[model samples]
Target: MRLQMHAVKFTADQSLLDFIQAKLDKLDTFHDRIISGEVFLRLEGADSNKVKEKIVEVRLMLPGKELFVKEHDKSFESATDRVMDVLKDKLVRFKQKRNDISSPAIAEAKTRVDEEDEVYEADEL
Candidate 1:
């Protein structure tokens, strides 16, 4: 998956970026059709009680739908891990639904429709 990363208020180092990339790359095993994704790493404003709380937002582009997850923690790694867990469950469910739609019954129904269309075209000719 192609991923674009954005750092909101601070610069992210190479090791941190590498960590995130490794985590996201593992997601390919769950769903190979993932087209691309975006990750936003932000430090929450100082106005809040917690100083510089880490926030991670991820958006994944799939075949026909998009998955997004936002998480906050004291560290970027933990937040990213939480986001990955959520995305994994969602991808599994999506794959199951896609499989269900392509079952033999649906395929047979689609075949019938195609045959009817052919017959109608012949009559018109």
Candidate 2:
């Protein structure tokens, strides 16, 4: 899986970049076919609260669909963690739905083949 991270406005330091990369690398374990992803980190001004908050947006590309999750918090790490958690849930659902959609067709095909085999054997007997 390939990850491309963009920090808006300010340049991100090495440690922050490394941390983000490490966090993103683990996403592949959830779904290995993830083609690529984009992470957007934006610094937001304090609203009502005195502390500045960070906004992180994660977009992942799957085989047939795209999954997106965004989070807002005081720390980038926390925001990223939240976003990844949401994305993981979505990914799991996607996988299950995909399997569910294809499994019935597979079972139907197998039944048809078995029926054909039974008919052939009966005719031979």
Candidate 3:
């Protein structure tokens, strides 16, 4: 997957960029349909307590779909981890939804077929 990273309000070092790229690469293991993606890393202004929040937004593009996740935490790593967890769940659900074979009509057809098979087996017994 091709990942385009955008650092907002601050310049990200090479290591940070590499870290993000590697993290995004892992998404291929979850869903092979991912074509490309974009990542936004922003360092929020320090609050009165001098606490800085790192915000990460990830967008993954599939064949005919796009998935997005945004999260903020004290560290970029933690935020990225949160984003990955959310996206993983979403991708799994998306795959399941796309591959669903248990529509109401299909379920009814399968039920009837099973009943017929069971009746035939009972007669033989």
The lDDT, on a scale of 0 to 1, for candidate 3 is: 0.87
Q: Model 2 residue 75 lDDT?
A: 90
lDDT of 3 at 16: 83
Global CA lDDT of candidate 1, please? Answer: 0.91
lDDT of 2 by residue, 1-125 (tens): 78898988778887987888898888878787899999898888744445489999989999989998899998998998898889888988888877784688888988898988764566687
lDDT of 1 by residue, 1-114 (tens): 899999886789989999999999999999999999999998887456566689999999998999999999999999999999999999999899888867898899999999
Candidates in order, TM-scores: namely 0.79, 0.78, 0.78
Error of 3 at 59 (Å): 0.6
Give the C-alpha miss distance for residue 112 in model 1, angstroms: 3.9
Model 3 stretches astray by more than 4 angstroms:
46-51, 105-125
Regions of model 2 farther than 4 Å from truth: 46-51, 101-125
Candidate 1 at 78: error in angstroms?
A: 0.5
The local lDDT score (0 to 100) that residue 55 gets in candidate 1 is 91
- Of candidate 1, the 10-residue stretch with the lowest lDDT total is 44-53
lDDT string, candidate 3, 11-66, tens digits: 88999889878888998888889999999998777445454798999999998899
